[model samples]
Target: MNKSTFNTASAIALAAAALAGPAVAQQATAVEEVIVTAQRSSQNLQQVPLAVTGYSGAFLERSKIEDFNDLRTRTPSLTFEQFAPGQPRYTIRGIGGGGGVAVFVDDVYMGQPSMSSVEFVDLERVEVLRGPQGTLFGRNATGGAIAFFTEKPGSDYRVKAKATVGNYDLKSVSALISGPVSDVLSAKISVIAREHSGYAFNETTGRDIEDETLAAARAALRFRPNDDWDIQLNIDGSTRRGTAPWWDLMIEAPKSAGKSNPEPRRGRNHTDDGYADIDNAGVSLNANWDSPIGTFTSITAFRNTQSHNRANTTGLLVAPLSDVANRRVNFHTLFIQQADQKAEQFSQELRLAADLGDRFKWIGGLYYYQDDGVANRLTDYRFYGFGPTPVDGRYAYASTNETKAFAAFMSGTFALTEQLKLQAGIRWSHDEKDHTTVASGKNFSGFRDGGVSVPGYSAASSADWSAWTPTASINYQVTPDVFVYGTISRGFKSGGFSDGDSEKQSILRPFNPEFVWNYETGARTEWFDRRLRVNATAFYMDYTDLQVSVFTQLAPNLPAVLVSGNAGKAKIKGFELEWNAVPIEGLNLYGNYTRTESEISALISGANNLAGKKIPRAPENKFFMGASLARDFGGMTATGRVDYTYQSDYFSSINNVPSERVLAQENWDAGLTMGPAGGAWSVEVWGKNLANELHVVSISDILGDAFANYAPPRTYGVTLSYRH
Candidate 1:
């Protein structure tokens, strides 16, 4: 069925079911409770003033959220775009891109967008906090924050394992084991591995693209020496090898054309080599002490990563450049390129929490972060000039980027009365970064001295930034089950390098930091004897110094350049509504809707004018609905669930080009489980994108053509899991 027909039918069915649900009540049972740590303390989700979503480990597995992309459809006011494995950019409420959002595991920030794309394992829960989180998370959280809480070792021994096989030679294995090792020590270990053949075929090489192979492991240990002291250590590593997203000539255009054109369902044609590999490792230590006055906690961590990528953009640049230059770009072609990158980081945090009598509660923390990174890129250029002399140039560049940051933060809540409360938070942060770039070009044309000549150049630049952000909120409780609150918060995002061939021309120039002031009001209420819940939030953001990437050609001989510039000012406003209901025992229903609108009011500086343009990737409207039912029959139990998602059209590029626009899409998924309650084994069958819709989720324009990356096709799989 078509999307419109399916949507109409589904809506009618859901409405009917909801209307008839309350009358058929089974054994009375309260809705499941959700706990979250969005405010740096454990609290019931309903008590939090911010717009947040929390999911337990069981929920994650049942929903088949194996990676970050899977999260895009499940959450409201959030979107994800992936250029490749380990390379993802997020847009939250029209405020994201260029590392604007932050992801953390146990309060330790991943530091980079690429590093945050790793697989999750043995997780206790996942929480997504919407809106600015600058008061506590600091820089890079101008949009929002996502936190992954890993499961800790328990005193009881436990083991869980699962394996799966699917089409396209897809294979996966995962296991987790936990137990007490000694009287005072407990440990947990988890590992996951996956391999899959590609889905797209490359006619040029007669091979499949988009294949993936990955493995990851984590080990954790906990020590409780006394009633007042607790310590925990965790170490993890991951390695992956995957073919990068291949650009195809989706829209067949003449070599003389430069503008991008839209073409749906284009065929794949990767004529050149393309690949990516990554290796990452990290270790963390946490300690806590319970004292009479409060609880003191410390966290320290170190991480490292090495990666390499090689791809060909011949059609996008070399071919067009050669055609425009009216020169013979050699048969071997001068377009293949490779980049190698390495990074190392260390961080430490100290925090204290106390309940000061019954009138006030406070939490404070100090944090430090340091990182060092190096990247090297090499390019081959070959084009024959007028005199049989080709510009066979071997160009190489290396860059080093380093950063150091420190911060202090504190938050408190005061009870003014039995029904009124006031909360405030403040943070002071300082950051500094140094960047150095060295570049050289060697022309092997054999016309100018038959030898390599290098006019070597190097440049360095540094920037220091500091910011003080504060947040305040007032919450009122109308009753024991209803809460209303309002808050205003400030956020900041650090800025850095651009894409260019030289330091003076691009990479070394620093852009100003972007900032946002967000105002939000929300309410949480429970109805029908706590069996139904409703939450809503409305927000507005005043954004300034928007960091935008601009493309230009400073000179004919120089390579095309992209620079980070403070280009425009924008305003964003949105509202979210979420509801959950357990009208009858063994049946649960949930749904959410979000509406966001953003506009660029003025263009202060930049290459192109973007006034009156909507921010890219920020869908105007989105909806999600799901239902799950479970029942017992004799000694066996059966459970089933279904979820549907719909998103309005949105642009994928900054220019708001028509060709970069994605049409509205609807996706549906369903699953079933059969087993005894609390049994050691269970069988599950699941299907995703049941309607088999085709839609582009991301696009790249560098290849002289609009190359689109489509969402996954319809997929179904079955699995059997065991636990002891």
Candidate 2:
């Protein structure tokens, strides 16, 4: 950690200790309780018998967690990476990427990576479950699951609105209104708009880059005709327009010949200012019927997304040799890439829950899902020279993939005694996929020569896979304030063909499915009359046929292409410690620490045997600490909060090249709010990354050059909110 970060963290720690010293001597209060649905049923978080994290909507708003990247700083063993604004990738316990982790919104699966950065408008809570959850969640739950629950319409009327202004010309406004339309109907609506100026500058274009504008809206309706039947419907849509993420050229290519420096800067020399545009919309319907025997629930959902992006892949402005002296040219571009993607998915689920007796309870569910996606990409390389004419080479690639999946799952809990319980669950899943690809390239002898078409290829393939995943756990209540559990579970992820590869072999053969066996033990305890709560978990996972993506050349003269294949075996083990304390009334302290170790145990044949390499994006250690205090003075209330987070260094690729390593980082955030006691209006001032730390979040190495994406710099904002 740097000097500024160390000092900021130390100050917060000292302040927390100082407050606790005197507060501990006073009368303590019970910590707040959190309810979650990790097991497909509502239960207290401390009694869930799983490694999970829950965040209330109020807490998220106070912390200013606007997106998934902000949430990763507070959660343990969670890693988030984004090459651009709309495309995001998440990892948990060294397992992620390409269907390894499942994301859900109101019990509806989000199948596309572009949908990962949805707006957190009006939410009841967010839950992050670690380890395997395949038995209950069905397919693509190998790493774990993230579920987001939105607040439902209530009988009473409510209105909430918020506005924020920040540095970098940031502006945001959001509002939500919910009320009862009649005795049997309720409705709710929420909308948000946010915009910000660019953070980076384009030296060549003389314009700002990395700016963003977003707008989203959601509507919901609930109907209750009788005491036993209930129905709800939700619709949401969002649009995002932004410049491409800023990438620092950390290392120059060997062919550059001293034209660029190998240092990180906030300026780029791209000829064109790239752009990203994304549109996403979804709808869901849910119905429930209560009967004497059990409760039956049905959920049907559909989603569609489209995105178009253009970027200067090389991050360089190359001039033709003939115009080197003038330092100016008509076409001063080196390389450019453009991508257009479209995806749509539909899912249906039916579930039943019942209690046979006081000693046993069970739940069963059936699920079906289908999705289709298409991606078209273009790559232009100006190898020989720069001009207004045709370039030296141009490549176009397109792919379409379709998937269908079905699953049935059931789980039961039998209380052997008052203090001991046995839980078991199983799921049978079947998946089918069809993929097609078309690739072609055009080559030119020079800027003035005629173009020649290279050999093109088109191929199609289909594959199917099936898996039976199971889970078993034993739980014992040592006392009313303490609980312990041990569990074993299995997870599976289906396989598919690679895209952007023109080779016939790549399309003819599809990758195999990956599987994991996870073993875990955990404990939850409270002390000092429920004033302090602690939770700890230890887990180990064994993986077989692990799917991995690597960049390789199909031939000596062709450009590199990404290919997906199965690896031999791998292992990952990790432990987490989390604690929350309410030493005295109006004072709260919370923190978590995590340690992870991941390694490849074996490699496929003909490989150079990189068996012990660390998994990509898996940091060794992660720590978070925070304190919040609220005080009332006469007719007004004031709350102050401070938090710190730390993450160890990690590599961005399986190769673990030193140049591609993301360095360790430390961050600090603080916020203060003031309002009238029990009033309808309030104001808050918040700052993130107070230490102004510069750290890389992702890196890509191509052609001996390393490009890095850095986290956002220091930002401060003020918000005004009204509730009635």
Clashes of each: 1, 0
Residue-wise C-alpha lDDT for candidate 2, range 1-724, written one tens digit per residue: 1234323332332232221111011122677678999998899888988899999887788778888878899998999987766667788987888868889998898999887667887988999999988898966889989899988897987676777889988877777778899999999887777778887777767877778887777889999988998899999988888887667667666543314434354554667788988889999999999989899999999999998888775566554334466574433335677889999999999999999999999999999999999999887776433234534678787899999999999999999999999999999999999999887775222111112233777778899999999999999999998999999999999988887655556666898999999999999999998889999999999999988876554434333456678777999998999999998898989999999999988864223465888888889999999998888888788889999999999988776777678889899999998887777667999999999887776787665567776777888999887766
Report the lDDT of model 2 for residue 690: 95
Model 1 Cα lDDT, one tens digit per residue, 391-436:
5677677889899999999999999998899999999988899988
Worst lDDT run of 10 residues, candidate 2, spans 18-27
Instruction: Using TM-score, give the best candidate's number.
Output: 2
lDDT comparing candidate 1 with the true structure? 0.75
Give the candidate number with the greatest lDDT: 2
Estimate candidate 2's alpha-carbon lDDT, on a 0 to 1 scale. 0.81
Candidate 1 ranges beyond 4 A from true positions: 1-28, 251-268, 313-337, 378-396, 442-456, 499-505, 553-561, 604-607, 702-704
